[model samples]
Target: MNKIAIIAACFIAPILILVTMGIMYWVNHNTLVKLDVACDSQFAEIDNMLKRRADLLPNLVNTVKGYAKHEKEIFVAVAEARTKIGSAKTVKEKSLASSMMDKALGRLLVVVEKYPDLKANQNFIRLQDELTGTENRIAVARTRYNEAVKKYNTKIRSFIGRLVAGGMGLEKRDFFEIENPEDKEVPKVDFES
Candidate 1:
């Protein structure tokens, strides 16, 4: 009886430790993966919002063109930026394209400000309001994405978490950061009357 009890205890001890470790690893790994997915989804939402803004820009440009045909250069710039945004393939590329479009659109707005008629046009005003709202949403989504990424990255770098991430073949993801010279400068909008 004594020998049997000793044998049982010896076998069960290592098994219990292994089970506990496995459960801990699994829970931690799952949590990190969830965070990563949240980050990715938020970024996708931001991208979609940017695309929506870009889609609206062409119509806005065309409407302004009807009122101000002489501003051909600004119109062409807006068109080119929109095209670049549409063609963007990666997150980084999309960020650059968005920045470019912002600059072009700012220039267009400045030009539009010169013509009081364009500013007062019902369609133009409505589109402008919509675009502003979309931009605000994009900004909020970006903030959320950054927070999720920070949490995920912190977990990935932790000792045991790093081991688990490596075992799962998870790699670090890059944020959609814009560090270009053009992105650094605020879009010049000469609203001077």
Candidate 2:
């Protein structure tokens, strides 16, 4: 009877340890996955707002063009920046492209200042309002994305999470960080020219 009890104890101890380890690994992995998904979803929202802004830009440029026909260079630059936004893939690339768009749009607005009539045009007013709202949405989405990245990075760097992440081949995600200090400022929209 004593021998049988000893054999049973030896078998059950390893099984219990293995179950506990498996559960711990699973819980950690699931948390990491959830955080990763949240980051992706937030990035998608940013992308959507960018596309919305991009779509509005052409109309805004065209409306301004009717008033200032000789301003070909600025229009071309805005178009190029808009193209970059579409072509950008990675988070960093998208951020830089967005900055380019902001700069181009800023230059375009400078041209708008030269013609006060364009400022009061109904179409221009509507497009400007839409772009402004879209920019705000982009800012909100970017903040959310960065927050998600912070949480995810914190988790992966944690003691147990590091082991689980490394074992599962998970990597750290990039935050939607501003590469240029100038890009931190929202493009000013002063229609009072």
Candidate 3:
């Protein structure tokens, strides 16, 4: 209505709009970053679990070797898989290596089955328990990693998040999917007590 009132309205309205937009942008950007960080954190957990499993392999191999000295192929397969896992750099590389290690470990378990004493040995039993626990941990960690990746991927692909993520250079991430059908099989560890 009045000159001063009109001038104040013009200045304040734009400022308020600009401030609101700035806050919205900040929130969206931060959400994207936090989701990305969560995915990375879960990936680290998977890597650590894999490392723990790898550490137990050598001892288990030696213990079994004492009983099944002729089973050199299994030993070599496990050794090579462990080496591949250690040398892996990316998440995908590590995953493929893990699958290789799993197949090798599965074959080793079969060899142990053939030797009743090796299967019953106290040290072997303890190592088996530890390896089983570690495998469970790896499974859980991979689940969490995939969940985080799913959330992050959704955020980057959705409408509002897509706009923000694109401006921030964020991209969708792949889930920790098991590509090999053989790797999906449950390991045969059950035996009559």
Candidate 3, residue 121: Cα displacement in angstroms equals: 0.5
Q: Lowest summed lDDT over 10 consecutive residues: which window, candidate 3?
A: 184-193
Per-candidate TM-scores read 0.87, 0.89, 0.89
The lDDT of each candidate is: 0.85, 0.92, 0.90
lDDT of 1 by residue, 137-189 (tens): 87887778778778888888888889888888876766767747866776565
The reply for model 2, stretches above 4 Å from the true place, is: 1-7, 184-193
Worst 10 contiguous positions by lDDT, candidate 1: 184-193
What would you estimate as the lDDT of candidate 2? 0.92
Q: After the best TM-score superposition of candidate 2, give how far the Cα of residue 121 lies from its true spot, in angstroms.
A: 0.7
Best by lDDT: 2
Better of 1 and 3 by TM-score: 3
**Local accuracy of candidate 2 as per-residue lDDT tens digits, 52-79:** 9899999999999999999999999999
Candidate 1 — which residues are off by over 4 angstroms?
A: 1-6, 185-193
Quote the positional error of residue 140 for candidate 3 in Å. 0.7
Model 3, runs deviating above 4 Å: 2-6, 185-193
